[model samples]
Target: MEKIRLRDIADALGLSVATVSNVLNGKDSKVSPATRIRVLEAVEGSGYLPERAEVLLGRNPSRMVGLVVNDHPEYSGHPLEDPYNARFISFLQRAAVRHGLELLVKTARTWEEAAQFASIWNMAG
Candidate 1:
């Protein structure tokens, strides 16, 4: 089967391609909850992948920041479960937004895992 396009998703959902594009681009304020859920479901169920041009355009405006947290043994599998980590991340997120950056968070259970995640995402130090 051919890879799904934004137009194909829009046609299936009875929405304009721009609307679908905005939804996929994380502009949720422009879409209603019902429409947003429908679009999300359709995208997930159909396995939609944005084209390279679309991906580049989306990234061109801002930089992507990846936050990889290694869960501490005392934190029960997630460092964010502790208030300190949660608060720290919140501050980081605010700072990133203020600087016009996109934040991507992931849990890295070990040093190896963190390295793998960074390499996979092409993260900058």
Candidate 2:
């Protein structure tokens, strides 16, 4: 069996790669139901799996906020020892959910590692 790329499927369906990519990634905002179904069928037949991060990055922000909690021992102890931090984190999560936004949480052991991760994820605060 031969592997198929997204471009190949798009070409076969007489659609632009971006249009096909959007359909495969589940962006239904600008896509009609009929077109979405067709693209999905083509994708299934082609055995192509779109990259999730690429899809996510292309999506419009829906009140989504990424949170990075540096829980290093030097900063804060276990949740049992520092209940305030835990409570704050819980509150943020609840607030994000209430607003229909996803909260991405990341923990780092070292300050350097935290900085690097923050930079990579564009979560600098």
Candidate 3:
């Protein structure tokens, strides 16, 4: 399949590419809420992937932090069930939101899986 670009999203939402770019770049103050919703919906629905270069350059609002926890053999239940894990995630989520970042929590039994997940998502620790 062809890669989805910002222009495609803009066309899908019937908005200018510049407007979509602004929204994705976190400069949406000039864009209307309705338009922003439409843009975001289109982006999500189309499974659009922004340019990695843009994300790395901090041009896009794709600042994401990955939280990896390893406690599989010792713990039987989900990681969220642990009080300490829950509290840590809560604090991390709050900090991420406050700084306009996205927090992705992933639990892996092995280092390989954790590394794979982080590599796939281009996540920063």
Candidate 1 lDDT trough over 10 residues, lowest sum:
116-125
**What are the clashing pairs of model 3?**
none
TM-score to native of every candidate shown? 0.48, 0.41, 0.50
Q: How many backbone clashes does candidate 2 have?
A: 0
lDDT of 1 by residue, 62-106 (tens): 376789887767778868777887998899899888987777788
Write model 2 residue lDDT over 1-125, tens digit each, in one string: 66577889989988889998776544657988888778877776665644543354454643556665667676565532457767887898898778776676667665544543443332213
Q: Sort all candidates by TM-score, best to worst.
A: 3, 1, 2
The C-alpha lDDT values of all candidates are: 0.73, 0.64, 0.76
Kindly report which residue stretches of model 3 are placed more than 4 angstroms away from their true locations once superposed.
1-61
lDDT of 1 at 123: 36
- The most accurate candidate by TM-score is 3
Q: What is the lDDT of residue 57 in candidate 1?
A: 42
Candidate 1: residue pairs that collide: none
Candidate 1 error regions (>4 Å): 1-62
Worst 10 residues of 3 by lDDT: 53-62
